[model samples]
Target: MTIQSLGVGSGLALDDLVTQLLSAEREPKEKRLNDKEERIEAEISALGQIKSKLSDFKETVDEMRRDSDINGREPTITHPSEDKDIFTAEASNSALRGSYEIAVTELASGSRIETADAAYTESTDQVLTDGLGSTTMTFKINNTGDSFTVSVTQNMTLAQLREAINNNENNFGVNANIIDTGTATGGAKLVFTSDVTGAGNDLVIVNDGDRAELDSLTTTDSTETATNLSPVKSATNAKATIDGIPVESETNEFENTIQNVSFEATSVSPLDTDGITRVTSTLEIGYDRDGLDKKIRDFVDNYNKIISDIQSLTRYGESDLEEDGALAGDSMLRGISNGLASIVGSSVDSSSLGGLFALGVELNSDGKLEIPTTDFGLGTGDERLEAALEDNFDEIAKLFTDEDQGIAVRLYEMANEYTSYSGLITLRERAAKDDKDQIADDRERFELRMVSYEQILRDRYLNLDQTVARLNQTGSALLAALG
Candidate 1:
């Protein structure tokens, strides 16, 4: 049988009374937790935003650091194949985590090309079959190497064919255009041109469509490996050495190689012709201190608030409205509340990070993570830390950022390892949230029950009022009759 509450009546059910008391006892606690969660969420979101900004800021600082070092060396970029001032450098490292040191000469020009587009069967130029003006075909472009095919309609208008050719930009290395000859009898003619300038990979028009006695050239699109680069010479031609290993260059400078070698350019290298000295460098890609602090503060405030609610529900003092709280002495709630102690002392190998502990980032007597210093300001210990970093960066990056070993990564993995209901923060947090949600559901049920009780009480009162009025009228009538 379904149970419903009768709020008030001449007679009351024991179950209804208990339920009303329970609602009063649980509502406040759930409300406390919900309010706490909102504040925590705000803090978390604020932290995330700040951290993102900080990461960018850090990248800017790093770039500045790079630029500040020997004035950012200008490097020339080039296409792989081409006969011109071409330079190359290579670096190799036993580990994956260090920056490069190079002396690069700026190239006079950098050559690049767009990948080919798809092919289609709707042609325009004299390149198409006769009487196929209304017909259309299609094809595709390949990046590594390869020419694509296209067919034009017979005697198609130059403008119409040009449109068709341009329409198949995917297959063509170049875009097509129609030129107005300006002659009274002349109309626009289709012209195909390359988007890039260079000897290698220069636009080559292939005979993909039938010439039908126009001289049938049978071949598919072929990969056009580039040749002839721009005037960017290797500075090492004069003299260069990589980590004391003497290296040779034919032109001005070497760049983008895996090796951490520096070239001693004989004179002031005119690498960047743009004369643009300062360019914004690396893009920042990590979190910052303020963001982290905000997260920490949020966790603290939220955790505290949840604690307060739990205390409110499980141990309401005499001063509280309720003498005995609804969840009082619930072992599960108390146990869950205490589970927060785990992360506070969550251990990471202090030595693994190389003097990570000496920076006033310490473990307290009670085994909690402590940063007596205001910031994760390893940057302040710049000179000494940098000196150390020069030698141990790979290890340091590994301990703090590597997916398997970094603190953040470890915490992230742990955060999702939920034994019960899954959540982001801590197990205790998950438990508290789950508890709060559960109680909130109970509160909803209680409110529904209260509505039924209110109706029953109203009806009972009405009946009593009517009965008294009837009795009064009957008594008056009897008295009059007796008189």
Candidate 2:
């Protein structure tokens, strides 16, 4: 049987004493390991916050690098005398500033044709050709004479014929449909329309079968046929004039007709007393000032947010009772903050727009940036940035986007150094994780050693208890012998 405890025979608290001795040695060591682990974990979390802030700041800088980025170009249009509903225009980055007189003479039209009424009296499933030979139908567009052919075999229904024409691989610029007139004699009719809109791009359908049989099914003439299959609409080109110069387009929308400007003619111009169209509308393209200002303001707001975050993380408290931030006194944070400030203050040699200061962006006492409403001793007025842009458009553009010297370019390059896969932030996080793992390993080894040490102390105390019991029994035997 196992003994209850080492102190049972000796009548002393040997187990309690051993536990007290071992705890004295283990508590301090365990606390040290725990403290180290806590510090490493805190560092890892702080680095993650830094990485997130840097990423947001980088996005703002990237916007300044490309022409299509935020506030890159703003184009506006003003019409003097015409209704905007009649026509509308849009301008691209390449559009030049100018005013032009535009007169819409005509709008483009597409070709539409419908078959004669009652083209199919039988059910939709009935064979279209009876027992006769196959019938071949040809379709042409734009009078080019290049045709696509559709063949109808015996036992094919009118519905099947519609599907065959649409599924034909050679068919181009034309589509067919079946329309029901809801009458006994005019049961159903087949219609065809040209996808393209132009003067000559008409849908011409001709059948190579018997004239009477083919005429009952489809029509090729411009006028109404006996089968009721006739042209409902004719193809026509769009006509307009730019500055008294006539221009023709296959569609109502015209692109690149006058530099980078594109316009769509939605309605015909009002006519004069002589039955000729004479109305003209003025088209103007210019820079959008409000849009550019909004972009600049957004950049300032984002920069300020980053600055506030860094400052909070690295600030030292004023008193002992005040707690310090997780990353207080961190050298990495200091380096990043200084580097961004330097880039913003440095001037670019490629443009007259020196730096952010010249652009009306100033750092406040709190280390955050702001766009001031009034001039900061700069000769330019309260709206200095806007004035600069209006006067020196090219120089302002170069200041933000120059190849190697631009402020935006330099900031982007610095951000990549901290956020890349092999960046300093990534390496620091990895090192902290390794230190935490080592502390865990040490704690496990210490616990195992404590278990062995406790067992050794119990064995030594058990031997001492046995020796004291024997001595007590010997004393009792001597007292009885003397009595």
Candidate 3:
């Protein structure tokens, strides 16, 4: 007899036995795989966290490694009056530390030209005659040779001409508009303004087509020999005097006039009571002490932040009940922390400022950077930092940016070694993932084996069921014959 289910013939609980056996075989192996996978996942998470922190620290160090950012110039202007500003000035790193007296005489201006009185009877008046076909008006700046053309159709109105000039794609800073003077003498007058500012650089509109009807909008005569439009304002250069020495610029801003300093004239300086001599303002160029100080403080903060993150990621739990850190006992974190500390503590040969110590930056008991309050014969951290900024300001840049042994340079290089595309952290993450994949394979194989083991158990139970069923039938037949 064939048994359809386990224990059907024997009336025994073989199904429960098969279930218990499978459970016993699967529980231990599954628990091991689960524990291993959890550890690898934690490792991956910890690696990502440390890599992110290092990248941030590297970016900050990258900026600090540049000398231009550390060595800066501060320009201060003191006008004659408290309310009015005569000019604004900026200085570069190469600017010398000095004071100058500047007086602004004139501000730079652009040219403004307007059409002759009643140039057009109305805004709708035709600019080109019906048989004139088309006219091309060219706008030119005399000194700069910058020019653009406007195409006027034969039936184009004065308003349409203004739109064409303004809408030209090649227009280099020329603006055209019409103003209604509200009378026949000065009817609708078209105005042309040129942004080209300099003495002798005038806006000269040419009647390229030589059409007399378009002469009202042109600066030149029909024969291109004389002026037709009225000059409202002339283009002029900005003028100022430095220390009684006269200077001029095409625009309001004077660049490199004082070596590496540039200043923009806002308005004419105040005149004396006689209205002849102009009052002067004082401009002083000095080292950007406050800016450098802030950068230094920021560097210290960023360094400390990275250190704190590494510490948190690598620390171990003290008690058995507490869980350990994801990266506990990891050597990579220790190496990174130690490497940064070593660079921060080491001295540089390039800068006269020596090292971070010269800037009053110290490593605290917790192995983090700080500006301490304690004084050690030299001065308190704050006092030393202030003195360094006041005295050896420029040398401070070499301490952190020098190519050979700069703190910032070395720190950046070290961080890159660990966080780069194929760096140590990335390799560690890959290896952890590989282990996880291996565990997954092991789990799949174990499941396949469990399936085969269940089949074997069911086959043995089926035989047991058949044997018991045959014996019961034999015993029942024997008892019935005896009765």
Candidate 2 ranges with C-alpha deviation above 4 Å: 79-84, 103-105, 117-127, 132-153, 163-175, 181-187, 203-234, 264-282, 374-376, 379-382, 460-483
Q: Score residue 450 of candidate 1 by CA lDDT.
A: 69
lDDT of 1 by residue, 124-200 (tens): 33444465443333332222254454555565544565565667646545455544554534433333444333223
Greater-TM-score candidate between 1 and 3: 3
lDDT (Cα, 0-100) at 198 in candidate 2: 81
> Better model by lDDT, 1 or 3?
3
Q: Estimate the overall C-alpha local distance difference test score of candidate 3.
A: 0.89
Q: Which pairs, if any, clash in model 2?
A: 115-229, 116-227, 116-228, 116-229, 127-155
Q: Residue 11 of candidate 1: its Cα lDDT?
A: 35
Q: Positional deviation of 387 in candidate 2, in angstroms?
A: 1.4
Better of 1 and 2 by TM-score: 2
Look at candidate 1 and tell me the lDDT of residue 199.
27
lDDT of 3 by residue, 78-191 (tens): 999999999999998989999999999999988999888876888898888859588788888867879898888888998998988899998988998988999988899888
Q: Provide TM-scores for the models.
A: 0.43, 0.81, 0.93
Candidate numbers, best lDDT first, in rank order: 3, 2, 1
CA lDDT of 209 in candidate 3? Answer: 77
RMSD of each: 13.0, 4.7, 2.3
